[model samples]
Target chain A: TPFRIQNYRTLAYVLTTLVYLVIGAAIFDRLESTQESISYANLQTRIDVFRQQHNMSKSEFENLTRTVESRLNYRKKQWKFIGSFYYATVVLALVGYGHAIPYTKAGRAVTIAYALIGIPMWLIMIQSVGERLNSLITFVLKRIKRHFKRKREPQITAMELLTCEALLTVLTLATGSYVFHRYENWRYFDAFYYCLLTLTTIGFGDLVPMQKDDYGSIGWLYILFCIMFILTGLTIVASSGNLLILRFVETNTKRSRNERYEM
Target chain B: TPFRIQNYRTLAYVLTTLVYLVIGAAIFDRLESTQESISYANLQTRIDVFRQQHNMSKSEFENLTRTVESRLNYRKKQWKFIGSFYYATVVLALVGYGHAIPYTKAGRAVTIAYALIGIPMWLIMIQSVGERLNSLITFVLKRIKRHFKRKREPQITAMELLTCEALLTVLTLATGSYVFHRYENWRYFDAFYYCLLTLTTIGFGDLVPMQKDDYGSIGWLYILFCIMFILTGLTIVASSGNLLILRFVETNTKRSRNERYEM
Candidate 1:
């Protein structure tokens, strides 16, 4: 019966998520579909004007458009050493920005092989670091409590660690946004969006940083900083998520075990 | 000392992974960079020829190219109800195909808010489903073993479970590839690559499905099937990864605890 209850509970969660996704889909469609149509029409008009200006036939215009589109996609040098390294990190992190994807068949094959091993390795590494970070935070919290001469021995609860992680996440986002704003010359809001997307690993690539041909100077430093920022931010979030999920599963298992004992 | 050793081992893993990434980057660069340059040059030549043929000035051609690129990006109707649902699933999974990202500021803002809550909830739900899947497989394997009437009790080992999971994953890939190959008209290899990328959640949108306006009569069926395939594939992979990481962490923790006890 407990097993059945657990299955039922999971089913409920799945149903709820489906509803949530539907609501989100509706909201996104409402906010974006009209804008998408307006923009699409504007682009169509522009293409039509260009065709008329050149006295070009439909087939000729289509051919030129195909050529120009492919050319525009590669305007930036995305396969150089540094960019390639960036691509490697993105793949390992499962961020897959699509800004600099593998263009050749061999590249795709290698990507598949590389990701098969790299992703799990990366996950373990980040999560290992995250656990350590959690311990370090817990130790520091305990010391702070001791310094305050608290009446209790100051055992750090999961809730406390969670709050600490949440704070660190916000701090990381704020600092990351400011840094990207300065380096990438994006508006602050856009930079914040970029940082959030990267941390979540959603990485839509709409506003990827380090994309310009010229980073002025200290480009390597900026790139290194960005990579480190991504790694470190994910660790913090992983720690937080780890705590949340483990506590959740632990509670559920404990409840079910107790119920079984009662039965 | 054991604590220090654990830290050192984690550090070693981190360093090794860095080296691995560097090697991969070199390989990818070597494999793909020359092609990139060749393609880039070819595109440039075509653009130049087109500009000269049209007697278009530099600025005029630049403006036209920008409009064409923007227009080309939206040739697909990616904001319809079904497409939006697909988009929602991608974001929630953090696959982020980027085929149909939010256009308006409101959409982006809502996306941020939605992901903040939805991502963790989705993670928990998927992991729960994955755990159940794992248990179900183990149960079935035990049942099959008992049917053979072995001398010893049919105990399902972790290794056995792992092998089963691997076989299931490969089978999922094979069948998924075939189905997508039939439906989306992609080459078999490309369909396999799509399945691999989707399962890894490193969804490079270069070969996203459902892009064509004409999906024949069973378009909705195809869409539903694709979504189900993605979810099931991810759940299987998550189950495998979960077993792996938990076993790894358990062994490490056991060893360290034993070392502490010895001290």
Candidate 2:
């Protein structure tokens, strides 16, 4: 019953975060839309001034303006509903791809306030999921250990644990690379590099998948799964690293104690 | 003696990380420079082709090329030594400002490899520093408690700790805002927002400071100091949050235990 209550609490927290994101998206859209329009107007004025200075014909001026407008339009497209949602996700996760940034002062303020609350909420959500994943990992490891015991093998050592962690990390990297190579049309090495960068949360934005037009509907699903996978992978890797450090410290302390006793 | 050993060990780790960063920067610079030259040549050829096709005069072509070259140079500046160092710091911190991304495939791969080793090293450095800072904070708190005791006041409670954390956060935000507003020539609110965004490690990259002129030699030092301040601030806030969460969980568990006994 308590476990159920905890699950419910996590669900509530998640739902609250989703609601906040939706509201944030709407606010960002409104704030940024006004700024975008003002900038567009300013661009038009600049184009007009340039056209007059050059004494360009209407058709030539139209061509020049069209080129500039299209460039601006491409940028503006990133602030739409779905794009804003993606931006909010990045901000909450602290990945901050920096593809779409707030232009208005109000937008910046709201963004700061939103992140102040949103990041912790996001962390809580990730922590809950990570805890569950950790439990599952432990269960699997225990089952493997039991199997080894039944086979009359030696007990699992710290070295074995370290090896297992290293193997998992390599496997995760390989699998991620394979998937991204196919989806993003990248080279195998680039895909692996992207996976490393993303899972580490370095997200340099040089190679973001799902932004290209080719993937379409599947892109969204792939991105969702990839994010979850990355988060889970990071949690596992961090825990393993922590365990390794703990073991090393424990051994050092024990050795030092023995030396003190001998003295 | 162990504490002294720890201090030495931490120093060694710091030096090792610095050495690693230096090597990484050199590698990145060589890799990126080669790629940049190739790209620049390609751009020059394309510009030449366009100019010839358009039958432009030498002066007109020069003007066009100059504009394009200036834009390229602006981007190229970010790959310079100081900028690369900043980029490295952001990547290792998992902040990923998404400015100055690696262009070459080899560069990307090297970045991934570098991060795999670098991030954990960076974390260890931050952790060691954070522990020292935490001890310092505790010592200061104890002194304040002793002062209160001398005044015959009530003992400090968890509530006071929470209040102190809140006050420190506010003070940090205000001080950062004041400093950055003066440095960046930004409005007070924008500076405050920038501080929040950066310290939280969201780093949207829309508003970067110290990249401008006028600050000169001090800008580098200021950036270095700001980064240290942000890292220290993050550690303190995280620890305070953890403490708060632990207290809440303990209270809930105790309440539940009492209820179970009653039942």
Candidate 3:
């Protein structure tokens, strides 16, 4: 019942994050659209002035304007609903995949304001879920230890604990690589690399998954699962690292104290 | 002497991180160049084949190929030495601005490998510096408290501590916003937003500072300072948040336990 209560709290947090994201996307969309229209108008005026100043022929002006319009349209198309949502996800998750940027002052302002709230909320949500996963991991590890105790091996050393954590990390990476390679049509190495990048939260966006329209809903689901996997893996890695560092510091301090006593 | 020793360790860590970044950039540069050449060759072959199959005129093919070449050149231009260094910083810091991404399989693999080592190292480095900063903050706060004590207000409450932290955060944001607004030629709100996004490590790259060529060496220095500022700000914010959260959680648990006891 306590775990269930925590789960409900997590669900609430998740819902709140989603709501924040949707609101961000809508605001971004409107802000960007307004900026785009203003820029387009400015461009139009500049083009008109240039044509008039140069006494350009109608056909020449039309050709130049068409080229400009096409370029603008291409830029505009990059901010569609899905793309905007992706941008929102990138910002909230602190990935900042600069594929599509907000060009307007208001858009940039809102982005800063949005991220100020969204990032902390997102972190809290991830940390909450991560804590749960951490407990699950600990429980699983303990069960394995118990099973081993039944076979007459009872003690678990620090090294053994580290190895287990490392093994889990490797397993998670391997599974992610396999699934992404299958779905994203990427090489094994690339998939593995992608898993590492996303898990580390160093999302370069060069090898992002599910960018294709064909993948659709499944792609979104995959991304969601990947986020969970990444968070859990990070928690394990960080905890292990902290343990190691603490041991290192302790040993150093003890050795120095002994040296000082001898002196 | 311990503080001195720690400072030395921090310096060593900073140097090592820089070395790691440089090496990563070099390797990524090479990997990406190889991939680019191969892709260009492939594109050239495809274009030739298409022209041959379509029985296109030489002039028409040349025109088309020139257009394609220009596009490729534009893409290539995004990966200059400085830009790549910036990219490496983005990756290692887990900011991943996605402005300059590794396109090659080898480059991506290296990036993953590099980040696996680099992210933890960066975290350690940030935290090392952060701890120093934290102590400095504590010292400063104590001095401020003592000053108030001299003015006959000796008692310091949790609210006062919280207020002090909040004030520091706001002051940092305001100062950063002013400096960036002046340097980046952005609106005040946009500058503040940029500060928030970056300090939170949600670097959307929509409004990055020190991006103009005119800013030159000064721009680079500004960026370097900004990174330091962001790291320090993050450490302060995280610690303050943690303290607040811990207190909140403790109170909540106490209240819940009391309710259960009453029931």
User: For every model shown, what is its TM-score relative to the native structure?
Assistant: 0.94, 0.62, 0.59
> Model 3 TM-score?
0.59
CA displacement after TM-score superposition, residue A224 of candidate 2 (Å): 3.8
lDDT minimum window of 10 residues, candidate 3 chain B: B254-263
Residue-level lDDT tens digits of model 2 in B90-146: 776777767555655545655666677666655544433333333345446667767
The alpha-carbon interface RMSD of model 2 comes to 18.8
Clashing pairs in 2: none
**Residue-by-residue lDDT tens digits, candidate 1, B142-187:** 7788889763567778889889999999999999999899988999
In candidate 2, stretches whose alpha carbon ends up further than 4 angstroms from where it belongs are: A1-76, A79-81, A104-106, A145-165, A216-220, A238-263, B1-76, B104-106, B151-159, B216-221, B238-263
Q: Tell me the tens digit of each residue's lDDT in model 1 across A110-133.
A: 999999989888987886777677
Fraction of true contacts retained by every candidate, in order, equals 0.62, 0.21, 0.21
Instruction: Compare the candidates by TM-score and give the number of the best one.
Output: 1
Best by lDDT: 1
Report the C-alpha lDDT of model 2 over A1-263, residue by residue, as the tens digit: 43334334334543443343334334333333344345446555654664565566768544433333323323223444445555666666677766655655545666776677665555544433333333345446656767766654334454665666677788888888998898878999888877777667666766666566546667777866665555556655654654554344334334333221111
Best by DockQ: 1
Docking class of 1: medium
Q: What interface Cα RMSD is found for model 1? A: 3.5
* Candidate 1, superposed: residue stretches over 4 Å from native: A150-154, A252-263, B150-153, B253-263
